[model samples]
Each structure stands twice: as C-alpha cells, then as structure tokens.
Target: MELRSMRYFVAVAEAGTVSEAVKRVHVTQPALSRQIRLLERELRVTLFDRREGRLELSAAGRGFLPVVRDVLHRADAATAAAESLAAGRLVHLTIAASPTTLTDVVAPFLATFGPQDPLPTVQESSGPEALDRLRRGADLAIVSQQPPALWSTRTLAVLPLWAYVPRDHPWAGHETVDLDELAGQPLVVLDPTFRPRQLLDQALAEGGQALADPVECGNAQVAQALAAAGRGIAVVSDDPRFDLHGLRITQPGGDHLSITLHAAWDPGHHAAASLSALAERLEIFCRTRYPHP
Candidate 1:
C-alpha cells in the first residue's frame, strides 16, 4: 500500500530474512517484520514463505517484483528529474518579448548571448498573449514595461533603449539622431498591442508631435528584419550585436533612453535549482547584452 512498506517488503525479499534486512535498512527486526506483514495485508496476498528461520519467495511475490521495482524506479526518477532541472542540466529557458523588442533589441541580445552559455537552451515567443504565458508561468519575458504588470510578484529588471533608423536612410551617417531630427521621418513602430509602443506614443503626444504614417509590426524583429531589408526605420534598443547595414540604431538627440527591460519570476513556485540558475544567468545575460556603454 504505502511506498515505504513496499520498499521494506522488497528489501526483506531480497535480503532473504527480516533479521538480515533489518541491519541493511537500519530498522529494528520487529518494525521491519510488521511493515512487511502490513504490505502483505494491503496487497491481499501472501508475499513470502518463511521456514527454518529463512525466507523464500511466494508465487505472488515473484509476480509482483517487477511491478514494485517499477514503482520504485518511477519514484527515483521523479527525484532525479527534479534534481537535474535544478542543476540546469536541461538548460532550457523560455522567454517572451514584444516583436519589436525581439527584432530591434531582444533579438540582438539573444544572438549575442543565448548560444554562449553552457547548456543554454532557449524558447522564445512574443505579444500580449505570449506575455500572459509568463503570467501563467514562463521562465522569462522581454516585454514593454521594465517591470511587467500581469505578474508583479515576479523577478523583473530593466534594459536600456536605443534609437533605431532605416539602414542607409541618412541617420547612419550621423553618430546619433536627436529627437528633433526625427521630426518628420515616417516611423516603423511596434503594434499598439504592446506596452512599449504605448510609451513611445504617449511621449510623442506629450511632446505635441503627431507621428507620420505609422507602419506597425507585432514585434521589433519584424520591424528590424524589414529595416535590414530596407523597408523602414524604427526606434529600438542599442545592443552591440545590432547592425547598421541591416538597420541603424544610434544615440538620438543627445538623449539616452534605457528601455524598461524586465526579468521576473513568481515569488513562489519555479523549477528546481538548476532551472533557477538559468534564471539568474538570464539576468546576467540582459546586463552584458544591454550595457550602457
């Protein structure tokens, strides 16, 4: 019945006598014998034949050996799996970010670091619904707000901002584009579905500037991918791996805006330590990838 009693029964069967197995199991002979008998009653079958102060297997016991071993194997495996996950043996980290963040900022960040970590394995997705995956339980999410809202109780941090532009669209010649220089340029933007786009739109509105025709992408990478293809200019984080030939992200208007890059986890509940280490490594990753310099 109970897993412990099953272990006791199996040990006694293997040891050939309760007197012998008690020492092996560090239990008193009487206690071990009682447990074995309890297991026999629970299973409603005689498991051992005792004669001449020795033990012999019963037909039912022999038939049940593999089944008991299997249950023990599974329980052992469950513990092993939990330990492996804690040690980062699997090295799987799931991340979600807005598309714009992915292409223009998060994309470069991952490119620079995702493949480098020992045992690093990553899964990525984006959009409001995807961020909700994190709320439900995802390892990491690269989203608009520096601190995500859906699960405020998670481990979150910030990322710096970069000025994005169309490759070879003239800003490339300049070291940086000022806010005023962007005055009349058409802006390729993240869809309003994300929070970062909301922030940009709000700032523009407060500054009393109406945007030019806003071409929207669900994520930054789509915009960045387009920019790489010479489709449009965008505002994104300035990660070191970001390319100008593909698109341009430079200092703008003598201002530095660090995007709210957040890394978070549920206060309670998470993968074992190895997986937790993966989370910590991700934090280090965001820092190295998005250094202010």
Candidate 2:
C-alpha cells in the first residue's frame, strides 16, 4: 500500500531476485522480501512466483505492473513540477528521444534558445519508449512511430537511412545504393529498438530480401566504426562519423529507405501550446537543415 513497497516490488520484478533487488533498492534482502509479501497480502494477490530460486512475475503481477509504473511516473512528475514552480519557472520542459535524435536534432535546436527562453531537460529514450516517457514526465517525445489517439503529433522530417562505408569502398562514389544490393553485403546494422532498424525490417520484408551475415550493433557510432574497419556497410540514420561516406538507401520501387520523425506530446498538458509551437519550429528547422538533394 505504501509507495516504498511498490518501489520494492518493481525493483524485485526487474531484478528477478531479492539479492539483486536489494542492491538496487539499497535495502536488506529480508526487508525487501518482507515488504513484497506485505504488499501481496494487502492486495490479496501474489505478485511473483518463485521457481528454482528465481522470482518471476505471476499473472497478477504482470497485470499490476503497468498500473504501478504509471503511479510512480505521475508521482515523480508531481515532484518535478513542484520543484520547478518553487524556482519561479513553470515553463520548464523535458524532451524524450533516442541518443542519435538527441544529438542531431534536439541538441542543435536547444542551442538556439535565448536568455529569456527556458532550457529543457533531455532524457535518452528509444523509439519504442518515447511515448512512455511522456507518462514519465517528459513534455515532448520525438520518435518515428505515430502515437495513439488524443496525443498531439506532427511530422518533423523524413530522414534518409544511410549505408556508411569507407571512402575506398565501391559504393562510396555513388549517391545511392539499392536495398537489395546492401542486403547482399555483410552489413553492420543497429539493433531492433532503433527507428532505422524498424524501417529496415519493413523494407526488407516488402522486397522479400534478407541481410546476409549482418553484424548487429546497439549503437550507431559502434556500427559505423565496424564498417570503417572494413567489417561491412553500416546501415543507420545518424550523421556521418569516423570519416565514412554515407550513401542513401534506395528501394527497387525508386523510393528511398527512410524514417519519418514525429514530435508527439500529450494534448492535455499545461504547456501543450508551447510544445506545439516548438514542434512547428523544429519542423521548419529540419526542412531547412536537411533539404532534399
């Protein structure tokens, strides 16, 4: 029933064992375990099932997890809002986005803020978790996915997915390379959580093609590094790094392999108008900065 108990339950659920959960929650193993038991007894539902000394979420636990997470997020948001209000600035904002988007788009946009403008905080969130960050207190979420109904969203830009390679590579001189040809090569690609990977998966499925022995990396810089070392072409949407040349990915249908960035926010937020205006400015900035060749 207490918030601390909920925190302990979530920590145990994520860590999978009391020993590990104690390290995260900074509590003794016995205390954490007792708190979880008390929580389950109060709710009259077992939240976890112990099997082979491992703690796995029970059916009831899985159902209750989201509700608990939402509660914690709102609680955290309330704290942040109160702190911001106490500082005499109610216009503070937070943006949630992938690391690549944070570096390439949001950071640059923030650099244009003047003295009178409020500086926002940034949270590194992947494409799939962008909207969830809103519940976690982010004022804006920039991602490639379209948000559900009642959320305000705007198309920021359609950015090309690039195949990066060394300058000496055969594709270096070309402005574009077909997805089929790229798939045939041993490629370095980002993980499935990235927006570029999602788009790549869809394009490969539509073309009935599959990557051959592609090396999967979790970060764009690492993927580009592997490609630079002659590992293979790096398929990503990040800006060029490590002196690599990026070629646009083209499909057989003549359209480029690309991901459209969307700026999403809760329409009911207090700063909804400010977020919308910022999104519009970002759209204009992207259009001018990354104009089609």
Candidate 3:
C-alpha cells in the first residue's frame, strides 16, 4: 500500500520474523504486524505465514517480494538521482567497460536512460582498462572481466562473466568450452594493462593453456570487428553486440572463463551507503536483462 509499508514488508521478509523486522525498522512488533495486516487486507491476500516462530513467505508472498524489492529499489534510485541533481557534486560512478564493450555494450546500456536525464554526476570509465578508477576511489567499478575480486571493499558484488563473440567463430555452436581450446588461436583481448588480462591468464593457467600472442584492442566494438577481420577471437559480454558477418563465436566446451563484475565500496567512506544502493540498482538492472545465476 504505502511506500513505508512495502519497506516494512521487505524488512520482515529479509529478517524472517516479525520481531526482527520490528527491531530492524525500529518499530514495535504489534505495530509492524498491524501494518502487515493492513497490507494483506488491501491486497486481499496474506503475504506471510508463521511457522515455529519464523516467518516464511506464502506462495503469494514469494511472488510479491521481487515486486516489492523492485519498487523499493526504484524509490531509492529516484532519491539518489534527486540528491545527485541537487548537489551537482560529480557523484562519480566509474563504470569500467571492455574497450569494444564501451561502444557496443556499456554505452548502449547506459543510453537506455536519456542522455541528459538525472545526468548522474558520472565519469564513464571502461572496464578491464579502467580498473584504476576503482583503485583510486571511483564510486562504481565494473569488475566482471577482471580478476576474482580486484578491490577489497566493505560492500562488493561479483557477477559471473560472459563471453560474446561472433556467430561464425569455431566455438559458436557449443554452449561452453574448455579454456585450453582457445590456446594457439588468434586472441583479440583487452590490453595487457587491463584487469581482464588477469582473469584471462588465470583461466588459461588453470586449464594448462594460454593464448598464443594475444592482440589488444580499445573497446568491445573494435574487438568484435577485429575478431571478424580474422585478427583473433574477441572475448566480451552479452551486452556487447558481436553479430558481425563472417565470424562465429563458440563457448568453450567444458572449462569456461567466468569473469567477476564487481561494484564495491570502502567502509570508511561517508557515501558508502549511497554507493551500496547504487551498486544494487546497477546489478539488478544487469540481472533483469541477463538473468544469469
């Protein structure tokens, strides 16, 4: 019903008990229960059922939680966007994209929102190449194509990496691949200085193989073009388009390279809470479209 009611409901679901939710929301258990009751009455359905003093979402509640989370998340983003607009303080979100991905993937992803809307005091940083931004206090970083975890922060979320290549590449038909199969193939990779190199190296080493003379490029668009040009195979994500003609992309058969995309924040920073909220929104945005585990 009310925004605060939804918030309280979410708290109860997360805490797994009305008493704990009361403690978390800083309200009395009776009052929290009353609000929940009101919400159920308005919706014409009960959201939770108590079992052994623990609260569990009923079937309806299970379906409802994500909607509630999405609403709360959007509210949080709206508030952050408003504050960002007022402060005009360059609340920098340094999102690192792979070179080709910058033009082909990340740029397009960011474009879903109006170019001028909320204008998120941002500095678009490319991943793999832009890992430094994270090291030097950039508020948001893309770490999926990089090592397991590039920075140690109070809050960090790592997403599984994906490899998007042309449809004609040798491995295009298979669902996955063994890392060694990529050895000796022409490899179009992020520059050696980029964070993706670490992930690449680790994946290959574990499989006892390595790329033979990798050629580096600037962004996701260029990488795919390069791969299509027969320069080498370009590794990228689903967001980046790799549909160039005359090339095929194949996921390795068994072993695969799964990069971790991380959005993190140091605990000491004053805006850590804000950054964490932003991270959650970005991740949810990525998840809704990609839906990977």
lDDT for each of the candidates? 0.60, 0.87, 0.61
User: Against the hidden reference, what TM-scores do the models get?
Assistant: 0.51, 0.78, 0.50
Task: Name the candidate that leads on lDDT.
Answer: 2
**Candidate closer to the true structure by TM-score (higher is better), 1 or 3:** 1
Ordered list by lDDT, greatest first = 2, 3, 1
The TM-score of candidate 3 is: 0.50
Span of ten consecutive residues with least summed lDDT in model 1: 245-254
lDDT of 3 by residue, 1-293 (tens): 79999999999999999988888899899999999999999999989998999989999999999898778766765565566667763343545544433443346557775543334333456554455554444445554443334353322333333444567766666655445555566777766555556667766676677777788775656776777677876764434454633222223553334444555444434455665665666666666654554
The 10 consecutive residues of candidate 3 with the worst lDDT sum are 152-161
TM-score of 2: 0.78
**How does residue 90 of candidate 2 score in lDDT?**
42
Candidate 3 residue-pair clash tally:
28
Q: Candidate 2, overall lDDT?
A: 0.87
Better of 1 and 2 by TM-score: 2
Give the per-residue lDDT of model 1 (tens digit) for 115-181: 5343332345544555565543455565545455444332324654445654556666665555544
